[model samples]
Target chain A: MSKIIEIKKLRKVYGDGVELVALDDVDLTIEEGEVLSIVGPSGSGKSTLLNMIGLLDTPSNGEIWLKGQNISKASSKERARLRNKELGFIFQYHHLLPEFSAVENVMMPLLIAGVEKKEARHRAITLLEEVGLGDQLNNKPNQLSGGQNQRVAVARALAGHPSIVIGDEPTGNLDSKSSDMIYELLRKLNREMNQTFILVTHDMDMAEKTDRILRLVDGKIVCEMLRDGDKFVTRDLCKLDK
Target chain B: MLELFVAMKHIRTRKRQTVLAVGAVGLAVAIIIVFRSLMNGSFETFFDIFFELAPHVLVLPKEGEEYIYLYKTLIEFIWAIPGVAAVSPALSTTATLSFEDNVENVDMTGVVPAELNKVTSIGDKYMIEGDLYAIQSGRRVALGDKMIEKLEVQMGEDVVASFPDANTMNLVVAGVFRTGVEEWDQAAFVSLETAQEFLGDGDVITYINIQIEDPYQADEVAAEISALGYDAESWRTMFPQFEESLAFETFSNNLILVLVLLIASFGIANVMNMLVLEKTREVGMLMAMGTNQSQIRRIFLIESGILGLAGGIFGTAFGYLVSAYFNSLQYTVNAPTAPQPIVIKFLVDPFDLIAFSLLALILSMIAGVYPAHKASKLDPVVALRG
Candidate 1:
């Protein structure tokens, strides 16, 4: 498979006097049409990594290549364009604008991509229907349930038909049943659209269900798990220190 | 268009704040309008009094002479000038009038009643008791109301007049007139022929008062008339103090207007700043959604513009209504040149209304700049966390 994204020796440091490293010497690659999970404990830089890959933040020292284009030195405006046209993001909380309805929220990303209003609206309606929110097209975020709002957000993330979707704990705020539903929906969309998805999660069961899992501990990738037919195999590179 | 829509939505959601801001602008605009209108009306009143009581151009004799010779030829020559509507020849001198035991010194003026009527509206408009033309037939005199009261004389009563030329005569009072000006009321009037005969200044007159077609062209006409070897004084030259007062009034009015608009702008700025602070998170979300900084600033500017427009329209209408009510009420004001209390009336100029409204709109738009800049400069990362 062709590599969709590549990171080389990425380092993200916070604070001035006493530096705190969020991501240190991290190197990773994501292939096209791949379903992967990034599992980490709290403060393990899962969100920092997602933000870096999503073009939401700039790295202190690193080169990130998205579809063979180096974006680490890109201007903010160019980065924003790339984010709007080539990538999508879903947060733990549904960040849907309270003033806009579900369909309108779904239409936001397409609008940001400069799509005509009529066409954007049509595409947003189709996406909302696909997410089982066809009956709640006019409902605002506050009027909808938490799971429904999350589903609307998911529809919004895919509205621009991006090549890769980055989810920072997409189901973390939902109940167990809603989390399962969201995961299943994501998996189904991944298989149907043949699009790459990188999800960050702490749920072991959810991590086990993905095609591949990268375990991050203290800003370093310690293990990689891959599914082989009905069985899963794990490789732990950091275990040699024990 | 989207910016406008979003701005309108925000304003609608914050109804109380919007109303307060709009009301502040409205009240400021209304006060400015009222103040300017009243000042304009008062100045107009002062000018009207000056114009009605004095001729636009007064042709006087040379500096050393008391009266102009060949006055008839001079009158005909002045009448031939373009823009000269009418010219009335008059003679004035100081005299002492005695009726019973009351005695007072008064400035006596002699005029041709018919010619004077053409030069000034005073004869026709201000005659209270007797006919102004009655002075033409008999050796009769018209005593001003104040003069009559001081002399304690009745109509048709005979009074002794002692002139500066050692001429004394008993003249019958034909009329009592009041011009609402204390100085003018203290003067007495008689036939021009009578004054020339009694004062021993025959075929001569002190001055020829000239009215013009356009009062504003008085200075030019006065200059043209002065070419005839006589000193011509325009009303503006006669009363430059009034013009100075008008200038000061305008300056004061403009200062107040600027201060009022400044206060109103501060009100708008305060509201906009509060709104930006409240919507910090929303601003971040919009930026994250690919809204440019310029677009965000434009939204806030449009919001302030709408508020200004609304306030301007409402305030202008309210000001007009208030001024109209003031015009309906009758009040008396004392003026230095007026003998009686002058009626006060408020007048609104359309130019002032339009200018003030535009000023309010511009001030409000200016007030939006700082807050809008603050909103546009918000960091998406920090704002989203907010």
Candidate 2:
């Protein structure tokens, strides 16, 4: 399978004098159709890494290659175009605009891509139905439950039919039942469309379900786990000795 | 298209704020339109009175001379001027009129009645008693109503008129006229032959009044007439004080308009700033969804544009209705120069309407810029953290 994304020597430093390294000397690659999870504790740079890969932020010193282009040196306009055409993002909080209906929210990415309104609407409706929100298409984010809103976000993330989707603790705000349902839905969509997903989460069980996992500790990948059928084989390198 | 849709949605979601911003602009536009219309109406009325009561151009002798010596030749020369509609020769002097025990000082104008009537509308419409031809025969005089009353003399009675050169004559009061102007009503008119005879000057006249084909072209005609070795004055040059006052009125009116529009623009700016602050999270979400900074700026600009358009339309309609209502009222203004109170009517100029509305629109759009810039420059990561 072709590599969908590659990162080399990624380093992100915050503040000038008393510098804090968010991601230090990181190297990573995501293959096509890979379901991957990045697990880390608070302040461990999981979100920072995902942000760099999603083209939402620039690394201080690194090169990020998305599909074949070096996006780290890309212009703002070029970055935005790549982000819109090739990548989708889901935050910990469902960021569906409260003023828009479910279908309207789902159609946002396609609309941003300059698709015709009528066609965007038709595609958005199909995506929403796939996410089991067919009957709630006209409901606004405020009117829907938290779990339902997250599902709407999922549908929105896929509206542009991007090659890769990035999620930052997408199910962190939901209950166990809702989290499980979201996980099942994401897996079903991933297998059906062969779209790669990079999820950042603290939930170990959710991390174990993915095809591969990378454990981050203090801005460095300490351990990696690969799934074999129904089991996860762990390779531990560093311990949190505080 | 998406930018417009999002912009409209933002405005629709914040109904109260949008209405208040729009109302501020509307009120400013309406006030400016009403004030300007009234000022224009007053100026127009004042000029209308001048055009009706006086000649468009007047020709006088060269400096240090009291009369045009070759008066008949000058009159014929002026009559042949291209734009000259009519020319009437007149001799004016301060004189005293006495009838029995009553005597009053009056300004007397001597004119050829037939020629004067063609040059001015003062004769036909303002005649209260006798005809304009009554003064053409013999040593007859046509007195204004106020002058007749002051002298306590009846029509057809004789009055002793004495000129500054100690020349006196007994003139019959043939008619009484009222021009609805106090200054004009206090004057008396007689034939040019009688005036020259009374003043003991042979065939000499003080000035010649010329009416032109187009009143607005008075300056060019006056310049042409002045080239003929005479001092020619257009109505504007004749009334410098009135022109100064008119200019000052226009300047103050425009100043008020700018001040009002400035205040309204601040109101719009304040509303948009608040909206930007309130929607910071949504802005972040949009940016994260791949909306460029220019697109975000366009959205806010479109919002302000919509507000301005709505306000301009509403204010124009409201102003027209209010001006119409004012015109329908029976209010009158009393002035010292006018014999009767003049009725007030608001004169709305289409140019003023278009100008004020366009100014308001531009101001509102300018007000949107700062807030739109702030919104566009917001960092998506920091905004999402909020």
Model 1 lDDT tens row, A1-242? 89999999999998999998999889998999998999878888887888888887889998999999999998867877887887777878788877788988888777767787799999999998998999999998989999999999899889888889888889989999989988898899999998899999988888888899888877888778888987778775644241
User: C-alpha displacement of B386 in model 2, angstroms?
Assistant: 2.1
Off by over 4 Å in 2: A235-242, B49-52, B60-140, B149-151, B159-172, B178-186, B191-216, B224-231
Candidate 2 chain B, poorest ten consecutive residues by summed lDDT: B117-126
lDDT of 2 by residue, B1-386 (tens): 89998988888888999899889988888887788778877887887677776888989997889898898988888877787888999998777999999999988888988778767666777788887788889889999899988989998899999956857999999888898778888998998888888888788899988888877778988898788779999987887787798899899889978898889888889988998898898888888788888888988888887887677767777887788788789569989767568877787898877877788788888999999999999887887776
TM-score of each model's B chain?
0.81, 0.81
Query: For each predicted model, how many residue pairs clash, with residues at least 3 apart or on different chains?
Result: 3, 0
lDDT against the true structure, each candidate? 0.84, 0.87
Question: Measured against the native two-chain assembly using Cα atoms, what DockQ does each of the candidate structures obtain, in the order listed?
Answer: 0.32, 0.63
- Which residue pairs in candidate 1 have backbone atoms (N, alpha carbon, C) closer than 3 angstroms, thus clashing? B180-B339, B181-B339, B182-B339
Angstrom error of the Cα, residue A227, model 1: value is: 5.2
Cα lDDT for residue B197, candidate 2:
84
Give per-residue lDDT, candidate 1, residue A1. 89
Task: Please tell me what DockQ candidate 2 reaches.
Answer: 0.63
